[model samples]
Target: MREMVFEILTPREIEAKSMETITKELGGRTWPEPEFSIVKRCIHTSADFDYADNLCFSEDAAKIGVEALKNGADIVTDTKMAAAGINKNKLTSLGGEVHCYISDPDVVEEAKSRGCTRSTVCMERGAKLGKPTIFVIGNAPTALIELHRLINEEGLRPALIVGVPVGFVNVVESKELIMTDDMPYIVAKGRKGGSNIGAAIINAMLYTMGR
Candidate 1:
């Protein structure tokens, strides 16, 4: 079954789209960090709002940060949350805390240059297991219904989830893995979204939490 899915990208298309979006976002400026480009695109693609409003970038920390923000997460996961084009100041000014989760000492140094104080890493924070721990599984072949089963059986109902699984990855299956109580949820047209789409919930949660 795994072999049957995700054939759409054709390798070249993925590279083309990824590169195109990366270049557009960069606008001739060299990427601060190459890996972040993937993070930037994922956030931009998944999020449902214009960064001009309330927004925050969780970086690879999307799985945990996404849920946290959904539950009033004022703490952003990355120090470059501002560069991601999310309205970082708006949320901060409103008293939302930004949790910049960085693992690399070099990245931490870079984050300090970017004016970051609160940050951590997966090892520091630990593997966010159970049902509610996000995982940002995109474009998985499984549908929302079955995913919900895992959530129900495993008892992983996170505070908020922006399940916008796209592509051929098991993202869809992962997306459906939460919300047994009709919890706050946001989803995009399958294959029409990405990880950052979860930012809307993050912002909303921050707004509510700060209020």
Candidate 2:
């Protein structure tokens, strides 16, 4: 066997190369401008070109999200990892804050008492916080379900819903339900999302605006 050779690259250099690769591979395929740029960024983050086919967006999703951010909207995520993954500096520059309550003692206790996942209560809690908010649900289908309920039954209208929870159980159903609702949303159709993917979507918007 031949000896293996490896080369290390800086993070910025790696990211530049990835973007070049994605652009080249697109091969003149015309994607909806602005929105498609963010989608491409997500694909870069996950190294999952499948996002080009799986990601769906409501007509006004990108516009609403960017406007909300410009006007200072609060962002909520189902998991702490998603919250941590967001670009805080960019978010703050736009006067937004990222929130995650899944691990809160109150949320945990409520979940146990109600026989539901912490994500459900955390989303409910987030909905009550106020309007012009963005909910990024990446790891829990139940959280997406809870948001739908709050929007329809409780009339809690958020600024934007990023529903991309990755799982075999209830994930597809949850995303489909969100698609049916009269709200701005970015969804990963099927079961191919995670905390990182969720953060990537939000960061894409942030990066777009920051530029």
Candidate 3:
């Protein structure tokens, strides 16, 4: 009979070991300063090394995102689960807030009236916040599409767009649109992202900011 063995380690130790392993497994590939941090966190969260290759960042996007967070840029997500997963204490301490409006009564009503998705209306509402904001869309492709429309037509420029929605529908296309736009963005270029990836990206920036 084979003996069962358990490696005992604290949560912190386990995380440290995991990161070390990720770094070691990457071989000679190297990532830039802040981008490295973001990539590592994404890999840590998903246990998937593909994040290291799939994550796309616009010119100076990591810098822009960190600066926005420092200057109290509010964050809006498509789903409450992503909102809940964020490091709210750190964000609040930085004088920023996290919001998810998909379930709002007004959003629901307006989407129903317009025959569109609540995610579309949620982006519209987020655009109206009139503050430095970051849009993290990890569930609905419509949210990304609406954001693109708002940027092109209504001239709504967010601090950063984290476009990493997962699915086979419009997910890949929406992310492509965001990447083409001349905005500071961090996107996962494929149908391989989720709410957890969105939250992981935010937390990575927050942690990099010394929060």
Q: Which prediction has more favorable TM-score, 1 or 2?
A: 2
For candidate 1, write residues 80-102 as lDDT tens digits: 33224344665556444433344
Return the clash pairs for model 3, or none. none
> Once all C-alphas are superposed, what RMSD does model 1 give against the true structure?
16.6
TM-score of every candidate relative to the true structure: 0.36, 0.93, 0.95
lDDT: the better of candidates 1 and 2: 2
Clash total of candidate 1: 23
Candidate number with the higher TM-score (1 or 3) = 3
In order, the Cα lDDT scores of the candidates are 0.40, 0.88, 0.92
Q: Rank the candidates by lDDT, best first.
A: 3, 2, 1
Q: Return the top candidate by TM-score.
A: 3
lDDT of 2 by residue, 13-97 (tens): 8887888899888776646656777778888988888888888989978878888988889999998889999999988988899
Candidate 3 C-alpha lDDT tens digits along 1-211: 9989979999879988988998998886777878888898899999999998899999888889999999999999999889999999999999999989999999899999999999999999899999999999989999999999999999999999999899999889999988888889999999999999999999999998775
Better of 2 and 3 by TM-score: 3
